[model samples]
Target chain A: MTAVPDAIDQALGIAPGSPLHALRALRPEFVSGAEACRAAVLDPEETLDLSPELRRAIARRVVAGAGHDRLTEGYPRPADPALAALADGEMPEDFALAALARHADLIAETPAKAGPEHLSALQEAGFSVPQIIALSELLAFACYQIRVVHGLGLLKETRA
Target chain B: MTDTIPQVTLKPLTWTPHLPPVEIEDATPRQLEAMKVTPSAKKVSPYVRTLAHDPDSYVARTVLFNAIMYAEGGLNRADRELGALGASLINGCKYCANVHARQHARLTGTATTSALYAGRRDALNPRDAAIMDFAEALTATPPTAEQSHVEALRAQGMEDAEIQDLIHSIAIFGWANRLMHPLGHSD
Candidate 1:
């Protein structure tokens, strides 16, 4: 009888296939579901009020920073130079105040900082309420991806 | 100039969400598929629809979410909801905390969640306390969640499946809290 491997096995490459390829073995439904979340966040057709480049930049920042310490690739590459810089954790001169604040919030560098004052500051920077919400989701979704990828990466590291 | 210290509330306080939901207009077939997995009763929530920009991913997330949350024969709903509420608090999503807390309260008919929301840990039963401690720890950045958390759960008489369910419950909130916190605001 074949012992069924856990998500950690397939996701971390402790099994026969690469992490990306091995993930199908754990539970196809979960792998597919997680991929779908990636497509929506990093590669979407909807012209987000926030551009795809900017969205990817946030994802880049999150993946690089999340604790997994693996998951170094698979993030969308931004074409815009400013976005590229942001993705690399640089604040360019033209960076939007709203974006900088949110990058701070999602990066989780200082948890207590993301309170009413920060929200008000973004509002004062001229973001409409809905846009602020969208930005929040974008950054948050980035963090979500970091966790998923990192979790899978961890499973790979300990595959005995 | 004298510095004024910010006042921290010591009493258990209630949490509520007050964001206006983003409403779906066309109800695209793909969007409809996504809505089925959510708890929404009518048109899909704006948040779900917004994510439907990539309908494939939306379907995938919804499917996974439903399995983790509504699947039969795992940890009971209220306990799972408590895990969610605990994670939401750590993530600072008042809206998610309110929604899941209300769900837990409604299912168990208990209103003691105020203390849980306010960061109080003294009065909880061993089970709820164990679950919340693990949830909050796991939810923290860099994840201070440790093997001791698991040991504490075992000591509380959680079987393997229940412990696995609890981990999934807390882990899913790690994903869910980040997604929902930015989608809307709550009181």
Candidate 2:
């Protein structure tokens, strides 16, 4: 069996059969850098103020926004009803963070279709400037993880 | 299909997405704690701060983001910005397109960033066009975009570092466009 690729290996496509072909991991620092990035986001043991559940929730919404079909591609996402609701367009008024995160996912899935209205909605939902920024980054990061997994997944397929 | 993208000057675009406008003064202890460790540069952009819901990932992303675009080596800022513009264009991320186009314009001058954002790849110079071609293809379809796209970069006189930088720029936007698209609008 092939060894599970590390975060750097996955991001840089450095495992058994990266699609890059012929190019070794360009810089070890880059690979480690990417690994640290992924771990910081996904790892539960890190020194972050955000809880793991919230991180997973954001991940789930991001994956849902991008496409649930990608779950098989090694994308990490959480499973939550509140987040699911937001992904589809319904932001619950009570749980502001979940609603905000859902809004962020919608922006991720349909960025081109987004407008000030969405932002206004978040404000209405009680998100602040920093909160909005955080939500945006996490929502955007969901795409990053999904895209990275999808890209690396393709490389894994090529290895076959 | 020549759509017109709004041309903002050499500054952050107008009308950023306005979330519910909750004064952060009421922020809970967790939010405040996250704020303390959040990247200092991100403090300036409300967009980056939106990730406060998931602070750890926020820090991770910031670190990765800084390293990718602002790190010591590999791709230069200009080429990286060009790659970002290309990916943003393909991903339909007006916010990212606007932001990176302005960045690209700052480095290379002559805002072809608008042209690329408008999806008018045909209007670009050969080199810029090639970078766009590769970035878009990679963004839209990474697996299908591998070998040939890399080769095309080579054909465009891109050295290994430039090619790598271009790939990171494009790939990162694949995520960035998704993120910003969900958060707000640009034009």
DockQ (CA atoms), all models: 0.19, 0.27
Q: List model 2 lDDT by residue over A15-94, tens digit each.
A: 55444432325444445555666565656343334446555566555565444253423344335665445443455445
True interface contacts retained by model 2: 0.38
Give residue B46's lDDT in candidate 1 (0 to 100).
57
**Local error of candidate 2 at B136, Å?**
1.5
Q: Each model's C-alpha lDDT?
A: 0.58, 0.58
Q: Which stretches of candidate 2 lie over 4 Å from their true place?
A: A1-4, A8-25, A28-30, A40-109, A115-139, A149-160, B1-11, B21-24, B27-44, B114-120, B141-146
Off by over 4 Å in 1: A1-13, A16-28, A47-54, A76-81, A97-101, A104-138, A146-160, B1-58, B108-120, B159-164
The backbone clash count of each candidate, in order, is 6, 21
